[model samples]
Target: MTQLHYDVVIIGAGAAGMVCAIQAGYRGLNVLLLDHAPKPGAKIRISGGGKCNFTNRRVEPKHFICANPHFVKSALARYQPEAFIEWVERHNIAYEERDNGQLFTLEGAGQIVAMLRTELDWAGVELQLNCDVVAVIKQHETWSISTSQGQLTSAKLVVATGGLSYPKLRASDFGMKLAKQYGLEVIPSRPGLVPLQMPARQRAWWSDLSGLSLEVAVTAQRGPRFEGAMLITHQGLSGPCILQVSNYWQPGEPISLNLLPDVKNVAEWLLDLKQNAQSLSGALKQHWPKRLVQAWQTKFEFDDHLANYTQLRLDQLGTSLTAWSIYPDDTAGYAKAEVSLGGVSTDEVSSKTFETHKVSGLYFIGEVLDVTGHLGGFNFQWAWASAHACAQDL
Candidate 1:
């Protein structure tokens, strides 16, 4: 078996691992980057519908949702969006900012992986993919990692394997597991940035409304508001707004919607159209889809015509139309999630260097950490920022 030795062993080849390797290499540390994936950064390639929205142009700590909200501040501030943008410019990667300050590469997401690969080359970081780590042992001043490739010894070990999001991408909770092995605390992990699964009874309705997308404000009970496009799916809801609010969603919670977001008075809108001799369904159809209007008509058939409906009834109908309530069957889970919400607890790791508070040279970063964000490229920023922080210290 081939034997390798390095000053630092980073157990991931994704965004965080690659960034850490570059940082450590430039600091004169022999860094080894390893992962089970063949190509590495598989998730990055498919992110942002292949364009790879790498970072939110406007990022703050609150953009992230964590058990402890303040933990992500230091790293985020240290490695700001401008710094990452400068790096992108230096690499000549063509990128543009989309709605809500989301930045994506025009040349496809592969450019990001390629750029990182190029940086790793310049930094002299050794990347070994298709290598599954079997075990790790803290051997006095250095750590020994047993892997499919071989045994490598290093003084510092950074776990950047990320969280379980897409199993197809080989995303795992190995980082959190590793942290636990070293006696570090870990927060419970959950699927985030995923679509909600509808009740079994609503399957027909979901299919009927499939491909129907509307710009609206979606909110979960006691959660944040997300205003964007929402799409009905076979499962339930999926789209920018649904995916955003899903990050803050909890099990058994009710989700609310502002269906007519731009229209202030739904009652007036309907009443004005009703006065034009339009049928109840036709009047609603003017503002919404014919199918949706039909569904609502079926729901309120008892009070058929607008003239027969009382003012209280009209107000109630408007309320129901404008503020729809929905309770999901469940989430689509990690397989469809953009990111995992919880992982290794931030309390166990340093907010600055991302190293474990109890362990001297061990660090955890990226999705492996408890820090998770909404669906607008915030996770990628955390990956870069946390990796940069650890690199600076190690």
Candidate 2:
């Protein structure tokens, strides 16, 4: 087998690994970045429907979920979103801002990948694709990596393999497995920013309303809440609102949805409509699609006219409309998740450098860590920030 040596070897040629390789190379270190995939940035290519939500305009430590909440502050503080925005501007990548400060490429996600590749070229970093790592072992001062290509050694090894989310993109448990091999702790991981599935009975009803979407306020029993557009999928529910709340949701937990978010004083409004003998469907039609209103009324078996309900019944109806409780059967799983919720425990990694506390010259960054960001461009921002931190140390 051919053997090679480098100052740094980064696994995974995704967002984090590429950035780290560029930075280390710029620092005059011989850096080699490897990936099992045929091409770089497969996930980036599909993000934001091919536009790629690269970063958010507003970012804070609070936007992330980690076992050690403070673990991300140092890296995030060192590399703000503005710095990334400046990089994008310097590359002349056209971008636009969407709701909630999300910044996306105006042309395509390919531009971002091309920009990173250009940087890597400028830094003289070596990239090896379709290289699968077979084993990783460390001696006193050097790390040995066994790959399909050959055997290699490096003074430093950075795992930016990310987490198991998009299996089609060649996502794997390699990073977490490597961490365990090194005697480091890994937090249990799960799917995040994924769609929720409904029970069979509920699924039957919701499936009928598939493709119908509306803005809603969703609250989980565990205390997390978000207001955004919710989509009725054939399987259950999705869209921004459901995806955001799913981050805090657990099995058997009840989620409440406000079908009438725009309506204040629903009880009084219903009472007046009841007194005037107005049709309930007509009132709901103002906020919901005609098909959705029809399907909801049929599933709930609600009467058409408010005259059919008494004052007490009207109050009950108002409460039901304002707080429709639902228990999800499960999430759509990692196959449909946009990001993984947890990975290498943050407690074992340095917040300032992303170096593993238990191992010298070994670092973890990006989605492979226990840091997960809220929906939108926050996850990508975390990737950039964490990579910058680890690269600076390298």
Candidate 3:
């Protein structure tokens, strides 16, 4: 195998690795970008339904969660949404702003990947695709990366293998494994941004509710909560709300959904229509889809008649609507996940640089590290931020 030398050798040519390579090359370091994929940015190609929600305008440190909590500020502060926007403007990529300041390409996700490739090319970074790295070792201050075809040496080793979100996109646990090999702490990895399944009995009761969606606040007890649309699928609950909460969810806990949050006077509203006595199902039908009303009627004993029902029945129904408890079967697992949560532990690396404190010249970036962002382009922002952090120090 050919032996090549570089000032920096980056593994995984995804968002983080590519960005790191560009920054490192700008510093006049001989940079080599490696990935097992035939091309770069497969995740970028499929992200945000192909338009690519690149970043959010409103990004605070609170939008992220990590064991250390404060490890992301430095990198995120260095290359924030504005900087990325400037880069987009530089490339003249047409984009449109969506809800909550999410930026998407008017052209396509491919343009974003092209722009990244263009930056790497301009900075004189060597791009090596389809190179499966077998192992990495540190001798003195340099890290030697061994691949199927050749050996490369560098003073800096970046594990940008990302997470096992899209296994078809070449996701691997290599990053986490590498951290462990070097005696760095690693968080247990699991699926995120995925749907949850239902128990057999629960599925039967809510089976008719499949394909139904409604705006709600879904919160797992003692975990992250989200307010958005909840969708009932063949498996269980999905949609933005469920996906967001799954990142912080633990097993054996029930989710509480506020069906009518911020809505007051439900009892009074029914009372106002006392002139027309409607069945409990018929009254709810006026507000929700006919199918949804039917499903609820089948599951719960509701009092529809405002004048005929006792005060106790009315009060109970109002409370039930406010807090609907539903225990899901399980998450859709890794297949449908957008990203993987839990990775190389934050304690293992320097927050400022993402390099191992115990093992010098070894860096971890993007989803490979234990940092995860909320849905809506925060993950991509993380990819850019963490990469920029280590590249500056590299």
Candidate 4:
């Protein structure tokens, strides 16, 4: 078996790991980054439909979900979105800002990966791909890692293995497992930024409305309200709105969706329609897809004209339109999840340096920590911020 050593070794070659390696190497540390995959940045290559939402113009600690909400503030404050924007600019990477301050590459996601690789090369960081780690053991002050390639040691170790989302990308629970091995607490993990599945009873009806999408304001029972486009799928609900709420959705909890998101007052509009005695079908057609309107006609059996609806019925319809409660069967799970919620408990690590409180020379960053960000570029920003913070200490 071959043996090697480095001043700092980072596991996972994805966003956080790569950025951490670059920062540490630039600090003149002998850095080695390892990944089990054949290529680095598989997640980055596929993010934002290959365009790569790398950061957001407006980033706040509020965008993240963690057991300790305040834990992310330090790192995120130290390395803001403008810092990454500056870094991208230095690399001559062209990017554009979309709705809600999401910043994506104007070219392609591959450009971001290529730029990171180039920076890694310039920083003199050794990147070893297709290297699977079997075990990690700490002896004295050194971390001894056993891998498929060989045994290696490092004075400092960074576990940026991320969370258990995107299993096809070789994402694993190795970081959490390592934390357990070192006596650190790990929060139970669940799928985040994923779509919700409808109940079996509603599946047939929802399936009929598949491919239909509409703007909506959706709120989970305990989560914040998000205004975005909601898509009806064969199984259930998706798109930006549903994905945003999925982070806070719990089993058996109902989600309230405002179907008429643009309408200032649905009751007033319905009353006006009543006065005009307009056909309900025609009024609904203006807002919904033809098929969806047809489905509603079949399910709700609306009166031919608004004049027929009693005052009480109109009040009920207004409430239904404003807050339609839906109970989801479950989430799409890790396979369809963009990220995972829950991880190494933030209380066990330093928010400034991302190093473990229980174990010296050990650190956890990115999604592997308890921090999970909202959709868009917030997760990537967390990755960059946490990595930069960890690298500075290394």
Candidate 5:
């Protein structure tokens, strides 16, 4: 049996752990960053389809959902997205701004991982990959961690072991379990930014429309609204708009989709088209795919020609087109989720330092800390900001 000691031991090598480790090491702390996986930044490597959306140009407290809404403000303000962009610039990692202010690598996500690894190396942080922690025991001032390799002790233990999202990437509930073990409150966690699954009948209908995508506005019942491209998948709804609304969606809640968002007054538009001797299918085909129009016509008993419909019928048709309501059976689950919604309750940790109120020298950050951001680069920003906050305290 071998034993090791360090000033800080971070139990995850994902976005938060790597950033925290590098920052702590730069502060002259002997840091040991460990992960069960053979490689660090597995999520980063696969995020944004391997390009890695590192951060967003506009990040605010309103963009995040947490048990304690104020928990993310301090960290996000201190370490803004511009700071990370500046850091990436320093590393000479060429990146480009994409839709919705998302910043992605020009080459590949590997460059972001490499840049972080280089920073860790230069800061003298020891990284131990494929080291699965078996046990964590705290006795007085020292924290003892038993891993697959050996026993280790640290003055401070930072659990950046992110929430259960991508299990294949070695994501686990270790952080939440540890929090509960220490008598800390943990919020119920679920999939966020994941595709919604439709009911059996709706699924069958949507399956026929699979591979079809269109721009629209989506809103969840009693939740936020997002306007972007919505995709019909074999299972149900997806794409940017659906993914964004999925964050706030709860089970049994209906989702409303405005199919004709650009058309303010559907009845007026249809009336004018009728005056122009246009057919309903023809007008719809101009905006929607031919197949989609055909399928939609089959589902809804709408007249083929606008002239055949009365004003009352047109008004009803307009209402249906403007607000197409859908009830999702469930989400795609953590397997397909971009991030987990809840974990260690933010009320149990310091908003400024990420240090647990119940456990001294123990911190929690990233997706495991009950802080979930909207779709796009907000989650990555939260990871970097929270990691920076915890590292500064360490």
Candidate 6:
């Protein structure tokens, strides 16, 4: 057996691991970044349909979900979107801002990965790909890692294995397991930014409306609301609005959707329609697709003219339109999830340095640390911020 030594050894060469390696290497430290996957940044390559939403123009603590709400503030404040944007600018990567300030590469997601790889090379960071980690041990404040390639030792170890979402990409719970092996608290993981699955009985109805899209305001029970484009899918519901609300959605919880988000008062609008003696289907057709109106009529059986409905019935119909609540059978699951909801508890690690308080030199960063971000590039910002914070301390 041969032994190699480094000042820092980072597991998982995804977004956080690469950035941390580059930052630490620039400090003149011997840093080795290892990944079991043959290629680095597999997730990055597929993100945003290969365009890669790298960061958002506006990043705030509120954009992240953590057990400790304040855990994200320190790192996010230290490394804002502007810092990453500046780096992107330096690389001369062609990028464009999309809806809600999402910054994405114009060429492809490969540009971001290539830029990170370039940075790693420039910083003198050693990258080991297709290396399977066998075991890890700590002695005398030094970490020893046994891998298929060889035995390596380092003073510092960073777990940036990320969360389990894309299993086809070989995503695993290695980080969560490693944290538990060290007696660190681990949060229960769940699929996030995923589509909602309708119950078997309701699926047929929703499936009929598949491919139909509309802007809607949606919220899970006791959760924050989101307004975006919602697409009816063959499986159930999807699109920006459904994916956004899915972060807070739990099983058996009802999701409320304002079908007519632009309408200030549904009851008032219905009354005005009543004044015009409009049929319910005819009124809805003005704002919705003909198929959607037909489906709604079939589901609710309320296609009568307004003249037949009394004031109270009109108000009731208004409520139904404004607050249509539906219970989802489940999420689309990890296979279809954009990210995992939870991992190593933030309480077990230092918010500033991302190092475990109980075990020195053992740190966790990125999605592996029970921190999730909302849609539209917030997650990538967290990866950059958390990695930078950990590297600064290392």
Which sections of candidate 2 miss by over 4 Å?
A: 1-3
lDDT of 5 by residue, 10-85 (tens): 9999999999999999999999999999999999999998999999998989889987788789999999999999
TM-score of each: 0.95, 0.96, 0.94, 0.98, 0.97, 0.98
The lDDT of model 1 is: 0.85
Local accuracy of candidate 3 as per-residue lDDT tens digits, 1-394 = 2237888888999999999999999999999998999999999988989999999998877878788788888888888899999999999999999887889999899999999999999999999888999988888877878897687788778889998887878888888888888788888988988898889877866667788888777787866668888888877888988899887677777788877644567667556556467566766665567888766765686645667767787677776776677777578888899988889988888888988888878889998988888888899999998999899899
1 or 4, which is superior by lDDT?
A: 4
lDDT by residue for model 6 (1-394), tens = 2238889999999999999999999999889999999999999999998999999998888888889999999999999999989999999999999988999999999999999999999999989998999999998988989999998899999999999999999798999999999999999999999999999988888898899998889988866889989999988999989999999988988999899998988888888888888788887888888999887877776766888888778777887888999899999999999999989999999999999999999999999989999999999999999999999999
Query: Where does candidate 1 clash, by residue pair?
Result: none
How well is each residue in 1-394 modelled by candidate 1, as lDDT tens digits?
2336788889989988998899889888888898999997899999999999999889988789888889989999999888888989999999998999999999999999998999998998888889999999887888988998877798889999998889888888788778888788888888898998899997887778888887888888766788889888888899989998998777888788887787887778777755765567665555577777676577656344677667787788777777778889788998898888878888888898887889888989888888888777898999999999999998
Q: How much is the lDDT of residue 16 in candidate 2?
A: 85
- Please list the residue runs of candidate 5 whose C-alpha ends up more than 4 Å from where it truly belongs after superposition: 1-3
> Could you give candidate 2's per-residue lDDT for residues 1-394 as a string of tens digits?
2238999999999988888899899999999999999998888899988999999988988788888888889998899999989999999999999998999999999999999999999998999999999999998899999999999999999999998999999999999998998899999999999999999877888898899999899998864678889999999999999989888888999899998888878888888888888899998999999999888888777888888787777777876798888999899999999999889998888889989888999999999999999888999899999999899998
Residue 16, candidate 2: Cα error in Å is: 1.2
What's the number of clashes in each of the models?
A: 0, 0, 4, 0, 0, 0
**CA-lDDT, candidates in order:** 0.85, 0.90, 0.84, 0.92, 0.91, 0.92
By lDDT, is 2 or 3 better? 2
Candidate 4: segments with Cα more than 4 A from true spot: 1-3
Q: Which sections of candidate 1 miss by over 4 Å?
A: 1-3, 267-280, 302-304
**CA lDDT, candidate 4, residue 169:** 91
Residue 79 Cα positional deviation in candidate 6, in Å, after optimal superposition: 0.1
Mind sharing the TM-score for model 6?
0.98
Which residue pairs in model 3 clash with each other?
197-329, 197-330, 198-329, 280-304
